[model samples]
Target: MKNKILVLGATGNIGRPLVENLLARGEQVKAASRSGQDVLGAEGVVFDYFKPESFEQAFEDVNRAYIMLAAGYVQAKDLLIPLIEFAASRNIKVVLQTAFGVDADDAIPYRQVELALIQSGTPYVILRPNWFADNFHTFWKAGIDHGQLAIPAGDGKSSFIDVRDIAESAAAALRTEQFDGQAFNLTGPEAFSYAEAAQLLTEVIGKPISYNAIDDDTFIDMLTSAGVPADYAVFLSSIFYPVRQGWTSVITDDVATLTGKPPRSLKTYAQDHRQQLANS
Candidate 1:
């Protein structure tokens, strides 16, 4: 029987591609978002993480779910627990998109949500993906366009997985029960510092872009000045402090193991998005 998968946040960076992949594989997809938005021709359902009432409708008749909690949300744990419990009651599997370094005892909100899912007794696969390479186009696009990538991650390297790779892995996990109860730490094939990434961008986009390692306060100020929410800007800057301390420098092959191919390299990403970088 073909699996019926519900992809929450289906319009997001990862969810959008995952939805397309699943549809290509002939799976039945219910694409759920806050506004009931549909991607391509998939079924659309309204879902709000802060509103528990919206979940039941979204989960109805679904055999599996791809879950991604939005950033800057305070009710992740509360929202996820009930959703997990309800899914478990209905015998549905869950593939949860989580962050690297989130464990059962960690104080981070994602960690708490993971704990809730585990304790709910639902069949689950946890994807602990590192920072995304697409952030160059999304989060850091302005800086890259302006020829300087400024961040608080001073001299730190990260294995930034491409968002498409993350989505492919999610689709793979959702399609098969083989990876249940396992947590995979997904990363790109190589680690690159911000400076190194800037160099790659320079080569691909034919411009001299540079990395500017600023203090956390300065980084936060830059983001806010660019009109990012102050709280979200601070939260984002706080994560980089760990990177500065060398927490995110490790590369992994889990992406290859899961997707049957090596993860995309930073250089490849830079080349693929050269137009955006060039025009920046």
Candidate 2:
């Protein structure tokens, strides 16, 4: 239990790598997921937001924790506040991963959770990451298989960040107290609209994948037809309103500032993940 760090959502895109980054830096790491299944190089523990009992076990012997909500659930405030409070009670430093633009309004659930953390008078660093470039492989892979990407995002660009940059940022936050009580908006090096992103994918994966700017109703219907939960699909569709309104196209140096290297561009993300993007 030597200066251990508990990483909730450890099996996820950012968590897994954040665990790796910390272990590489010689930190004792606890990787927490729903299953409590062991990661290769770190101890694993069970953690679920709805299960308050799991919090004590997950925080056991850990001096710091990275807090985040898994995808799908929208009641972020209800799910996150308890965990934040538990960590605060233990005086565990928190590095929270909430979405970009949440701080734009205090009414936002994630922002509210953030406020709770800051007001708790605990050491904390908030990392607000923009859209993930990995979504091309995870969320839109089926559309790529079908040669199209249908989303409600109109002619708008997003500075989609690589999840690796996010993990590194979190690791940086958890490794030191210098940035405590501060927040960083993490984004990639540049912005690209869905159409432009699709073209980059077409070149990287060697396929003609097109972008279809459908309406919100059509987007929701598409996600629902794809077996996504109806409520969650609507939630996903609502986020695109920011994209269409030109809010997500922001670029920031926070990634480089956090990790001491520049954030990867979309083209680089496509090139690195071409195999996943190419697969059906």
Candidate 3:
């Protein structure tokens, strides 16, 4: 029988690609999202984390689920624990997209969610991926277009992984039992500071883009002035503090170990998105 997997946040950066990868592998998929928009021919199911009653319907007949909490949603604990309980009751295995540096006792809300999932007694795989390279194209595109990659990260280097690699790893874990009950820290093959990343983008796009380090307050101001929410803007800026301290600079082989191929390099990513960089 073909495996039935449900992907939460289905239209998101990782979730969208993951759905395509799973479908290509001939797996049956139900793509669920807040809007429940149709995704690459997969069955679409409406799911809003704020509404717990909508979850049971989405979980019906799902053997496994790719779980990702949407940003700017309600409390992660309130949303995830109930849904996890429902999945446990239905015997559905869960694969969670988490953050790097999260441990059982970590103070981060996402870490707390991971702890809950593990203690729920349901089979699960936790993928703690490093910062994403696509952030340059998506989140920082405006900055790049403006000739600067302004961030609160001062001299911080990260092992930014590609979202596609994270998705492929998720698909691999969902298709087999080898990765059950495991926590994988996914990272790119190499680490690069924001300035180095800017230089690479500059070279690829043939423009003079540069990284400008700013204090957290200035970064938060920029995000808010650009219409980002206060809480989320603050949270996003706060993460760079750790990076500024060199906390996330290590490379790892987890992506290769899971996908049977080395994770894509920043150069490859830059080259692939050269057009975007050029247009910027």
Q: How many clashing residue pairs appear in each of the predictions shown?
A: 0, 0, 0
Best of the candidates, TM-score: 2
Pairwise lDDT winner, candidates 2 and 3? 2
Segments of candidate 2 deviating more than 4 angstroms = none
Measured on C-alpha atoms, candidate 2 has an lDDT of 0.92
User: Mind sharing the TM-score for model 2?
Assistant: 0.98
Candidate 1: pairs in clash: none
Q: TM per model?
A: 0.95, 0.98, 0.96
Give the C-alpha miss distance for residue 148 in model 2, angstroms: 0.3
* lDDT for residue 108 in candidate 2, whole number 0-100: 85
lDDT of each: 0.86, 0.92, 0.88
Q: List candidate 1 stretches off by more than 4 Å.
A: 72-75
lDDT score, candidate 3, position 39: 96
Model 3, runs deviating above 4 Å = none
Arrange candidates, best lDDT first. Answer: 2, 3, 1
**What is the alpha-carbon lDDT of model 3 when measured against the actual structure?**
0.88
Model 1: residue 161 alpha-carbon error in angstroms: 0.5
* 144-259: candidate 3 lDDT, tens digit per residue: 88999889899989999989999999999899899999999999989899999999888888899988899989998999999999888988987787798897998888998899
